[model samples]
Target: DAGITQSPRYKITETGRQVTLMCHQTWSHSYMFWYRQDLGHGLRLIYYSAAADITDKGEVPDGYVVSRSKTENFPLTLESATRSQTSVYFCASMGVAGDNEQFFGPGTRLTVL
Candidate 1:
């Protein structure tokens, strides 16, 4: 496995501002997912994509948008940042099936001020 990585490992932003977190993998995995880690909720799914250009909403996608125009890259954007959205975001990718082990990026810590 080539593994996965994320950009801007740490970020601090104000509420109402737009911010984006980038994720890239070299394994060419068929499935990718975005999730956020919070204090109480633990980890909540934000979005996922089965393939390039094919995406879907996950559990908490209200303030976020995602796109997968290429198999190796999936980026998550917060249209308007909110304090509640501040959390550590993780990007993960899996092979053929969802049951397969998912390779996760280092994570991006976003703090909405």
Candidate 2:
């Protein structure tokens, strides 16, 4: 999967705490991604994985960590949460032949106090 990023529907955490948002897909897509949605920037890429154990940073990778040890799961971690990191996170997946087509999961809205 190369096109969709998904996560839980909602989350709330305090500043300086660690948070992990998990994304899961039933289909074994070749590419999976993580993105954050904010007021001015729309959706910005955070990280992406081409396959299990193969991950790369995206547009806004700072303060974030991602891992893909399984095709169905891509987890994004915030080592130490901050108020500026509060936003809606998305998880997406795309098949090999679906050019520019991605299946998106229900987004997670994280609020850091």
Candidate 3:
């Protein structure tokens, strides 16, 4: 496949647990991003990676972390899951920031109890 894909389309976990969501892309895009969509908030960036071994924090990167060890894969980890973190996580990739369009994965719905 040439598009991006996310694993564990749905997940349920208790609060204070650690969970990792997987994201894979076949385009070998240079830019990978993690975002969470809540009810009212459209989309908030959690983390983004420019390339392999290069990662940066975004607007809402407090409880979430990301790594890009490979250009085609970027994984997001929740250090300590909370009820407030229960939201749909979306993974996206783009060739370049200003010159390319972003492609989003299906998304992973996480529920924290």
Candidate 4:
């Protein structure tokens, strides 16, 4: 797995339930990010981690949480899923911010009912 992989390529869940989307990369990149893509919103960041044990919130972190205890994995968890959260989730990674050319994983399409 030299590139990133996202699990549950498609998901359907009820509102108010907890769900987690997995991401894994083998490149050992320093920067990992989670973003949600919607019609008008292009792509909004949900969370990011610079390195193991170093995580931060991005533009749209509400209803979503992320952890990067390992360089190869960055999973996003939805504390309480909502209809508004239904969107395609993409995981990306780069070596650093300035020169980071993001490599995106095949997105996970989530539907909250």
Candidate 5:
């Protein structure tokens, strides 16, 4: 029984290069979220999708993109990676109604140079 998975738990990239982070959950939850955890700002939402084909921009959507064509998968892409974007990215998912508590994955540490 798999909960959630993230590819390339650690990543290093150069500025202006495109990078993509992958996330997948086996829970088949309806809501999925992407957040970047930094020092001062804390965890800031980047993008989220209510369901497949229904995605919305969150607090820090700039320089990032997300899509959910399937309930079990949500991928985030960095259009042009930047140094300031270096942070730990987390992928979380919640059920439909009961206990809307989010279950977060280990997280992907991203570093931009």
Candidate 6:
């Protein structure tokens, strides 16, 4: 089922540029998450969706946006890219039960200069 997939595994952009990262999952989980991994910050949640059309901001949501209109897809957009946003972004999902551990995608590495 390829459990989860992320597009443009690698990306590079200049400051102030706009970028979108795509994520897809075959499990059709009701919960999905977006996280970023960096040297100092480690892995921090950026946004999460409880279900289709129900989303919320996470620990670090500045300059970033997300949407989940389908149970299997969640896309993240960076309105204005910045060097600090250069990090590996991961998409994860969990069943609707709300108690299961999450399954993460391969991740997308992005760099802003």
Regions of model 6 farther than 4 Å from truth? none
lDDT of 3 by residue, 1-113 (tens): 66999998999999999999999999888999999999999999999998899999999999888888789999999989999999999999999756788999999999999
Candidate 5 local lDDT, residue 51: 95
TM-score-wise, the better of 1 and 5 is 5
C-alpha TM-scores of all predictions? 0.94, 0.91, 0.95, 0.95, 0.97, 0.95
Candidate 6: residue 12 Cα off by (Å): 0.6
Q: Against the true structure, candidate 5 has what lDDT? A: 0.94
Q: Per-residue lDDT of 56-111 in model 6, one digit per residue for the tens?
A: 99999999999988989999999999999999999999996657879999999999
**Per-residue C-alpha lDDT of model 4 across residues 1-113, encoded as one tens digit per residue:** 66899998999999999999999999889999999999999999999999999999999998888888889999999999999999999999998756678899999999999
Residue lDDT tens for model 2, 22-105: 898877888898989999999999999988999999999999999988999999999999999999999998778757478888
lDDT of 6 at 62: 97
Q: Superposing all C-alpha atoms, what RMSD in Å does each candidate have to the true structure?
A: 1.7, 2.9, 1.4, 1.5, 0.9, 1.3
The clash count for each model shown is 0, 13, 0, 0, 0, 0
CA shift at 34, candidate 1, in angstroms? 0.3
Model 6: lDDT equals 0.94
- What's the residue-level lDDT of 63 in candidate 3? 88
Backbone-clash count (model 6): 0
lDDT (tens digit, per residue) of candidate 1 on 1-113:
36899999999999999999999999889999999998878899999999999999999889899999999999999999999988999999999956688888999999999
TM-score of 2: 0.91
Lowest lDDT 10-residue stretch of candidate 4: 93-102
User: Cα RMSD for candidate 2?
Assistant: 2.9
